[model samples]
Structure formats: C-alpha cells, structure tokens
Target: MAILDYANPTRFLRLTQIVLPWLTAACLAAFAVGLYMTFFVSPEDYQQGQTVKIMYIHVPAAWLCMMTYSIMAISSLGTLVWKHPLADVSAKAAAPIGAAFTLIALITGSLWGRPMWGTYWEWDARMTSVLVLLIMYLGLIALWRTMEDPIRAGKAAAVLTLVGAINLPIIKFSVEWWNTLHQPASVMRMDGPTIDTSMLVPLFVMAGAATLLFFVLHLQAMRNEILRRRVRAMRLKAAAGSRAARMAPPSSPLSSPMSGTPGAAE
Candidate 1:
C-alpha cells in the first residue's frame, strides 16, 4: 500500500521537486571535498606511485556501475511482480546512467592499466565480465526504446534484466574465480581493507558523491518520462476526438426544407 501510494506520478513528482535541490547540493559538495582530498591529501602509493590516484575515479565508477544495475534489477522486480507504477520508469532511468558509469570504469581502468601493465587492456576475466555488464545495460536500453508501449517494454526489459543479473556476482568475484591481471578485492575483503585510511576516506567520499549523482539523474529522468507519457496521452485523446467527429454523419439540407414545407409538398 505504501509503495503504491508513492508510485503515484503526482506524488513522486512532488517528492522529487522537494528533494532534488538538496540532493544536488549534497552531490556537488561531496564531489568538491572528495576531489580535494583525492588529489591533495592522499599520499602516493609505494609501488604504484602517482598512478594510484586513478583508483579514486575508477573504483567509484566501477562500484556505481554495479550499484546502478542492482537498482534496476530490483526495480524490474517491482515492475513485473508488484506492478508498481514508477518501477518501469526507475529501471529505464537507471540504464543510461549505469551504462555511462560502466564506460567511465572501462576507460579509467584502461588508462590506469596502460602505465602499470604496459598495455591498455587484457582479456582477463574481470575485464571481460564487466564488458558483458556494459553490454547488458545497452541491450536493456535498446529494448526499452524499441517497444512502443511502456508496459510491454517494461515487462520485456524486466525479464532481460533479471536474467542478466547473473553477471553481478561474476563481476564481483572474477579475479578470485579466474587468473587475471585485476587485483583481488582489497576494500571489501574479510581482511579489512589493505588501503590506507587517508586514501580510503577520499575513495568513500567520491563513492558517495557518485551514488548521489546517480539518484539525482535518475529522478530527473523519471520526471521526464512521466511528462512524456502525459503528452502522449493528451495527443491520443485529441486524435481520437478528431476521428469521432470525422465519422459522424452530417445533417442533410433537404431534411430541413422538407420539415418546413411538409404540408405544401404533400
């Protein structure tokens, strides 16, 4: 019941309007502080040297890429199972943002890899699985675009998203599961993060910033989707009204004359 209440487009729009400004401010402030700490405060790694700084951007983008997909998968469940009104919009909105984050992660990883590994890329397990994730995001976006009806598109996309979610665990554990150039998990390990506190703090701040930015972008996208649907409905209604008017039979001039002079004509 509560979910349905919030699913109302009017209520969702009202809530987004109230929250968007604060969300934007928080995202901006977090990025500012995070960037400052990343470049200025964090020290160079003993081995990686200055090149380690790229992790600040690359790691967060990688995290958000998976996070955005997780969000979409959950929203897809809502769309398919619960039939929530905003579920499709949320899933659709997240696809492009996820794809962008995936792209950023890939590019930054390649840049970091070039100097360290002597090459821009390797066909390693981690890299390959992440590439698949990116493809899944693009495919979901394409599915949404190709369908004319939102409901049909939502259901189709939802099924595809859920099916594709098998890649999340693969992406997360690829390094451990297979031999790869990619390092095993450091920050999220059971051994409790080999990274220094100074570097970890900035990394977390940037991750927060990235997450907030995703929310802001997703909200704006859903709002736009709602407006688009409204415009489409109004246009359809107007077209239907025009068609009904065109189909109605016109009154005959002969009928009017016959009524006025019925007795004389008889």
Candidate 2:
C-alpha cells in the first residue's frame, strides 16, 4: 500500500524536486570534507608508503560498486514482484553509476597494485570476480536498451540481476578463498576492523560521501527517466490520433450543395 502510494509519477517528481537541492548540497559538502580528510588527515602506510593513499578513493569506490548493485537487485525484486512503478526506473538509473564506480575501483586498484605487486594486474580471484561484476552491469544495461517496452525490459533485467547476484559473495571472499595476490579484508573481518582509527576515520567519511553521491545521482536519473516515459507516451498518443484521422472517411462536398438540399444528388 505504501509502495503504491509513491507509484504516481507526478508525486514522485514533486518529491524529488523538493529533496534534490538538499541532496545536492549534502553531496557536495560531504565530498569536500571526505576529500580533505582523505588526502590531508590520513597518514602514509608503513609498508606501502604513499601508495596507501589510493585506498581512500579505491576502497570507497569498491564499496559503492557493490552497494549500487545491491540497490538494483532490491529494486529489481520490486519490479518483478510488486510491479512498483518507480522500481524499474530506480534499477535502470543505477546501472551507469554502478558501472562508473566499478571502473574507478578497477583503475585505482591497478594504480595501487603496481608498486605493491610489481605489476598493474594479476589474474587474482578478487580482481577477476570484480571484473565479472562489471560485465554483469554492462550486460544489464544492454538488456534494458535492446527491449522497446519498459515493462518487458524491466522483467528481463530483474531476472538477470537476481541470477547474477551470486557473484557478490564471490567478489567479497575471493581473497580468503584462494591463494590470491589480493590482500584479505582488513576492515570487515571477524576480528573487527584492523585498520587504525587514524585511517578508519577518513575511510568512513569517504565511504559516506560516495554513498550520498550515489543517491543524488540515482534520484536525478530516475526523475529524467520518468520524464522520458511521459514524452514517449505523449508521442504515441499523438501518432495514434493522426493515424485515426487519416483512416476516417472524408466528408462529401455534395452533402452541402450550394443550390438546394432537395436536388443535391442531381
């Protein structure tokens, strides 16, 4: 019932308009503080030295890369099960942002890896699984584009998203499961975060900033999607009206003869 209430596109747009400015401001302010903390406050790693700074960006990007997918998967469920009007829009809108975050993670990880691992890339399980996740995001985007009908596309994408979710855990535990070059989880381990408070503070701030930015982007994207659908509907209606007008029989000129109605046939 609550979901249905928000299904109205107009209502959603109205809400977004009211909240978007606030979200934008928050995103900007948080990012500023996060960046400042990341570069200025965080110290160099004992072993990795300056390369450790990349973690500030790489870690948060990695987190959002997974997080965005999780959001889409949940939205997909709403699309497939409840048929919530905005569900597909949310999922669709998130794909590009997820893809971008995934790319940033991959790039920054490679940059950090070169000095530590002596190479930019290795066919490590963690890296490989993350690559697969990126591929899944791209594939979902392609699927959405290839289908003309939004409803059909949404259902198809939802099914694919649910099926591909198996990769999430693989990405998470790949370091632990295999003899990989990738480092094991330090922050999210059974023993709690091994990272010092000095580093953890900036890491948390960056992570929060990234999450806020994702929401801002996602909401704006959904708003655009709703407007696009509205334009499409209007075009279809206009086209249909034109076709109907063309198909209608033309009125006969003789029906209103200038002389007299009684002798119109003559």
Candidate 3:
C-alpha cells in the first residue's frame, strides 16, 4: 500500500520532500482568504460587536487543540499496537504543536470572554478541561525527555497519552454536562450550523487553513525526528567503537627492536 510504504523513514522523508512545498502554498492561500473574509466580509455579532471576530481564530485553534491530541493518541496506538516505525515520531512531533494550539485557544478564549463574559476567565467545565489537556501535553513532552531510549520513551508516553484521552470526551461534553460560560457548539452539529452562512464560510476556511498548517508542521517535525534518531544511532555506534578500541590489549610485533640482531633477546 502507498501508505504502508511510508512506514520506512526514508520513504516518509521522500513523501514530505515532495509534498511540503505544495502544502505550504495551500496553507498560505487558505489563510490569506480566511483572514480577508474575517476582516472584511464576515459580519460582527449584534451583541459582541467586533469582538466576535475572535471566534474565527479561537474556534479553529480550539478544534486543532483537540484534533492534534487525537492525532497523538492515534499515533500512540500505532506505537503500542502496530509497531510502526514512524508512529512515535508522529506522536512526539504532535505534542508541542498541540500544546501551542491549546495555548492559543486559551488566550484567545480569554480575550474573547472578557468582552462577552465580563471576565477573562471562569473555572468552568470547558475551560478547566482544556487546561487539563494543556497540562497533559506538557507532561507527555517531559516523559519523552526523561527516557533516553526512543522505543522505551515512545511506549511509556503512548500509555500515558491513551490514559489522558479520557479527558477529551469530557472536554467536548463539558458545557452540556455542566452549566458553563463556554457556549455550546454552533457549527458542529447534526442539525446543521447555527451561525449565518456569511460567518460560517470564513470560519470553515480558517479551520481548513489551520488543519493544513498542522499537517505541514507535523510532517516537518517527523522528518526532523527521524533524522535526529539516525544521528543518535551513529553517535552511539562511534562511541561503542571507540570503547572497543580502548579496551583492546596492546600487542607487540614479533619483529620488534628488542628481537632484532642489534638488541637480540638474551
């Protein structure tokens, strides 16, 4: 399978090399369109005024926060179950990026909330759950650093990541499960989007751009990780060789100076 062939790091790197330029172009184009629409075309909320524009980016970042973690969780599964060589690389690369998105969501949410909620923060179910997600991201990153061996680190982090996944559903349903300042889903529903079409269009555009950006970043990070592992292996092999040379006993040749006629053995 084309996808399975990429299980090899070399193949995966080749795929990234070929696709990254196009992905970057598309991502930039989407962002340009999304931003223009957000600033010029989209209407402001009657109640929140221009503050509503924050939703364009806030919503996308929030989605990415969850989506990135989902990727990590799936990659973790790949590591523990499938033994895919690139799985840990994927998972490791996604963690920091996910954390960045989560942080963006929190900051933007706070800025948006101050105008709408009359405060920057509330220890509400939705907000708290997102905070927990950020903490988990940081923890997984630390776990990776704590272990020197990639395989062992990947397995350990994989288990922890899966454990943290329980929080995701809680984060999603928190507003519904409990009374919270965070609003319920507006666009993502079976009944269809509640927002007007004008606003929804740009929102979707922004979300798509954000998703593309994530993949671009993810792929680049994976390539770097694969190369990093290769370098580590080479360094270890060199160290082993040096140690072997040091441990080897020194030997004298049979035709040494002491055995010659000038200094023959007595």
Candidate 4:
C-alpha cells in the first residue's frame, strides 16, 4: 500500500520534500485567517469578555498536546507490533513537539484561569491530569535521550508511551468523573457544540489551522530524525571499519634473495 511505502526512509524523504512546501503554505495561510477571525470577527464573550479570546490559542494547543501524544502512542504500536522501519523515528521526533504544545496549553490555561477561577492553578482533576500529561511528555523525552542506541531506545520508549496512554482518557473525562475548576465539554459534545455559531466558526477555523501547523511541524521533525539516524549509522560503520583495519594481521614478504645460499657463484 502507499502508506507502507513510506516505511522506506528514502521514499519517505522524497514524499516529505514534496509535501512540506504545500503543508507549510497551507499552515501559514490558515494561521493568518484564523488569527484575524479570532481577534476581529469573533465577538467578545458576555461572560469572560476579551479574556475569552484566549480560548482560541488555549483550546488548540491543548488539542495538539493530546493529539501529538496519541500519534506517538500509535507509532509505538507500529514499532512494537508492526516493526515498521520509521516507526521509532516518528515517535522520537514527536516527543519534543508534544512537550512544547503541552507547555503552551498549561501556561495559557493558567492565564485564562486566573481571571475566571480566581486562582492561577488548582489541584482539581482536569488540571492535575493535564499536569500529569506534561510530566509524562517530559519523562518520555528524557527516556529517549538517555538511551544511546536508537533501536533500544525506541523499544523502551514505546513501552513507556503505551503505558502513559492511560492518562489520555483520564484527562479527557476527568471533569465528568470528578469536581474540577475547568469547564466541561462546550464545543465537543454528542449533541453538537453548545457555543454560538459566531464563536464556533472562529474556533473551528483556528482548530483547522492548528492541525495544519502540527502536520507541517511533524513532517519536518520526521525528516530531521531520519537524517540524524542516517548520520549515526554512517559514523558507526566508519568506526567499525577503522577498528577492523587496526586489528588486521600484518602481511609477510618472502626474501627475493633466498638465492644467496643456492647461487654462491656470482
């Protein structure tokens, strides 16, 4: 299948080179339009006023925070179950990006919360779980770096990623399961979004833009990872070759003048 072809690093690199330009352009265009809508078109919330606009950035970052990890989790499965060649590269590259998004979500949430909740932070379920998600992201990044061998690192990180996945559901349903300062599903609901269309349109537009941004970033990161791995492999091969050359036994030469004894007459 076409997807399987990408397991080959060469093919993947080619695809990335072709796709990245388009993705970048789309991402930039979406962000431009989304920002304009967020600041100008969407009216201020009656309840939160201008502070509510923070939702545009906060919500999208949070979505990416979780979405990036979800991608990693799937990649982990690819590494362990399917043994796809680039699976580890994909997972490794995504960790830092996910962490960045998580950090953004946390900071923005705190800023938004200070005005609404009268506190910068609380130990409530939703907040705490998100904090846990951030910590998990940090831990995974550390795990990858701590291991020298990519193959081994990937396998180990894959297990940890899968284990950490338990938190995803917890973060999502934390509000419903327990008391929390954070509000429950206003936009993502079974009955459809509760927010007014005016605001919803902007939110969805921003979400689309953010999603595009993630792909642009994700693909770029994957390319870098692939190149890094190639460099590493080359170095290893060079080191091995040098070591072999050093250890090889020296060659011996037969005397051309063995002759002296047999041909005495000169």
Candidate 5:
C-alpha cells in the first residue's frame, strides 16, 4: 500500500528529502571505516599477499552489481504490474550505477587474478556470465537513451531487464556448475565462510558501505528524474496554453478610462 502511494512523485520526493541526508552520512561513515579496516586491520593473504586487499573493493562491488540488477528487475516488474511511476525511475536510475559497480568488479577481479591466478583474465564461467551482466546493463541504458517517449522507453527497458535477469542465476552458480579460475563461494556457503576473521570484517564492512551508497545514490537520481518529469509536464502545459491563446479569436473589450475610444485596451 505504501509502495503504491509513493508512486506519486510528490510523495516520493518528500520522503527522499527527509531520508537522503541521513543515508548519505551513513554511507560516508561506513566507507571510511571499511577502508581503514581493509588497509590497516586486515592481514595480507598468505598466497596472494597484499594483492588480496583488492577483495575489499572487488567483492563488495560484485555484490552491488548483482543487487542493483535485482533491484532493476523488481522495479521493472512493478512498473509492468503496478504502473508505479517511481518504478520506472528506479530502473532508469539503477542501470548506470549497476554498470559502474560491474566495471569496478571486473577491474578489481582482474587485478586480483593477475597476482593469484597468474593471468589477467580467463574465459571462465563466472567471468563470462559477469561480463554478460555488464553488457545487459549497457543494453538497457542504450535502449533508454535511443527511445524518445519516456513511457515507451521505460516499458522497453523493463522488458530487457526481465530478459537479462536470466543471466543472474547463471552468474551465481557458474563456479559450482563448472571448473573455473574463479574461486568458489566463501561468504554464502551453508557450511559457513572460508574466509578468516581479519579479512571477513573488512569485506562485510565494504558490503554495508556499498549497499548504503547505492540507496543514497538511488534516491538522489530518482529525485532528479521526478523533477525532470515535472519540468516536462510544465513545459508541455505552457506550450498547449500558448497554442490555445494563438488559436483564440480577438474579442471586443470594454472601454478603458485612459482611452477615449470604443473597444479600448485596458
């Protein structure tokens, strides 16, 4: 019910206005703490040495990349069924952010891989699926930009998002399903994480920071998009009013005191 109600632009804007500052503060604080712990407190990897520090950035960014896509997919579904205005806003705002995180994940993964695996990249299952996910984000963004109509673009993007969602499972299970250079699950396994405590804290902290940052950024983008829609509506209305005024016939007017003639202007 609240979700439907917040589909109203003004309502969403007002809510974000109240929440955004706090979220931004939390993101900054978490990021600072996460970075400090990652560099200072965490032990260097026995095998990869200091290069393993890349995991702090790489793992969190990877999580965010997937989380953002999931958000886009859910928002698209909302747009399709609930017809929520902010759903489209959410999807549009999320695409580029997700892509950026995916890029970070790829770059950092490569850095880590070069040191540990002795190669910059491998056409492994996990790597390939992650690459495909990034491409999907790019495609969604391209579609949105190429289309003229906002509603139509949103619908098209939504469809693309849904289609791309199939890759998420593939990316998730790729390590388990095939032999790969990419490491198997660490934090997610039912038997508990394989990572030691010193490294784990930084990873979790970084994940929290990334999650906070995403919401803060998402809210800001949505607010800007809503304002854009408002401006467009106002411009369209003004244009319609000008056209109507031009189409209207000239009319006789009452005499003004300043003018000593019939049909004088005020």
Candidate 6:
C-alpha cells in the first residue's frame, strides 16, 4: 500500500527528501569503512599481491553496473505499462549513474588485467557483452532526451533496455560459456565461495558500500530530474501564456500608441 501510495509526486517528493539526508550520511560512513577494510584489512592475493586490492573497487562496480541496468529496465517497463510517474523518474535517474559505474568497472578491470594478464584488454565474450551493456545505457539516455513526449520516450527506452538485458547473462556466464581470458566465478559457486575469509570480508564490505552509494546517487539524481521536469513544464506553460496573450484580440481605450487625443484629433 505504501509503495503504491508513493506514486503520487508530492508524496514521493516529501518521502525522498526526508530519507535522503540520512541515506547520504549512511553512504558516506559505509564508504569510509569499506575503504579502510579494503586497503588495510584485506590480505594480498598470493599471485597478484597488492594489485588484487583493485578487485575491491572493480568487482563491486561491475556488479552495480549490471544491477543498475536491471533496475532501469524494470522501472522503464513499469513506466510504460502502468504509466507510473516515479518509474520514469527512476529509470531516467539510473542511466548516467549506471553508465559511470560501467566505465569505472572497465577502466579498473583493464588496470588490473594489465598487471595480471599482461594486457589491458581482451576480446572475450564477457568483455564484449559488458561493452554492449554500456552502449545500451548510452542509447537509453539518448532516446529519452531525443523525444519530447515523455510517454513515447519511456516506451522506446524500455524496449531498448529489455532487449539489451539479453547481454547480462552473457556477461555473467561468459567465462564458463566460452573459452575466455576472463576467469570463472569465485564467490558464487555450487560448492560455495572459494575466496578465503580474510579477503572475502573486505570484498563483501566494499560491495555493500557500493550498493549503498548507488542508492544514494539514484535518489539525488531522481530529485534533480524531477526538478528539471518541473522547470521545463513551467517554461512551456509561461511560453504558452505569452503566445496566448499576443494572439488575444485587443481591448484597449486607444487603438494604437500614436492615436491622437481630443485636441490633436480636432
């Protein structure tokens, strides 16, 4: 009931504003702890040494990139199907943030790879699919911006998002699904996580921190987008009013500015 109730714009605005400050604080605190754990507490990998530290940032970012796209896709579907206003806002808000996360993951993954794999990148199935995911994000953003009709844009973006979602599974299973330079799964295996406890804690903590930060960033971005919409609406309304005023029939005491007074007429 509460979830559906917040579909109202005023309700959402109030609710998000109330929770936003606290969420922001929590994100900052968690990030600090996660950073400390990643840098100081986690043991170095036997093979990669200190460089393995990059995984703390890289893996979580990669996960978020996919997770955010899923969220955006679902939100877009909801906006298109139910015409949920907040759904559109959520999808729009998630795009650039997701794109940024994808870019970070790619850059950090490359940095880690250069040291470990002796190259910056490989044309593996996973790498290519992830690149597709980033382009999908960009495409969604572009489509939304290109259309003036909100509903039309939302529907088009939603369709693109759903189509792109096919890439996510490929990204997830690419190592096993194909012979690739990328490694197979470590934490999520049938036998359970293979990672040692010492390294696992920081990785988990960093993942948690990244998730919190995504939520915080999403909320802030949604607020900004809502404001942008309001500004646009107001501008359009003002312009329409001005146009109407200009087109209105004149109702004046004098017909023209240069109209003569009684003495000048005489």
Query: How badly does each model clash, as a count of residue pairs?
Result: 0, 0, 0, 0, 0, 0
lDDT of 2: 0.82
What TM-scores do the predictions have?
0.84, 0.84, 0.84, 0.84, 0.83, 0.83
Residue 262's lDDT in candidate 5: 25
Give one digit per residue, the lDDT tens place, for model 4 in 43-81. 997778898799999888988988999999999999999
**Candidate 2's residue-wise lDDT over 166-262, tens digit each?**
6667655864466334455422121226677888888888888899999999999999988888888778768765665576643444644344333
Clashing pairs in 1: none
State the lDDT of candidate 3 residue by residue for 171-206, as single tens digits.
558645664344544322212356789889999999
Every candidate's lDDT:
0.83, 0.82, 0.84, 0.82, 0.82, 0.78
User: By TM-score, is 1 or 5 better?
Assistant: 1
Kindly indicate the candidate among 3 and 5 with the higher TM-score: 3
lDDT of 6: 0.78
Give the TM-score comparing model 1 with the true structure, all chains together.
0.84
Q: What is candidate 2's TM-score against the reference?
A: 0.84
Could you give the C-alpha RMSD of every candidate to the true structure, in order shown? 9.2, 8.7, 9.1, 10.0, 8.0, 8.9
| Highest lDDT scorer | 3
Residue pairs clashing in model 5 are none
In model 1, which runs have C-alpha deviations exceeding 4 angstroms? 1-7, 167-192, 249-266
Which pairs of residues have clashing backbones in candidate 6?
none
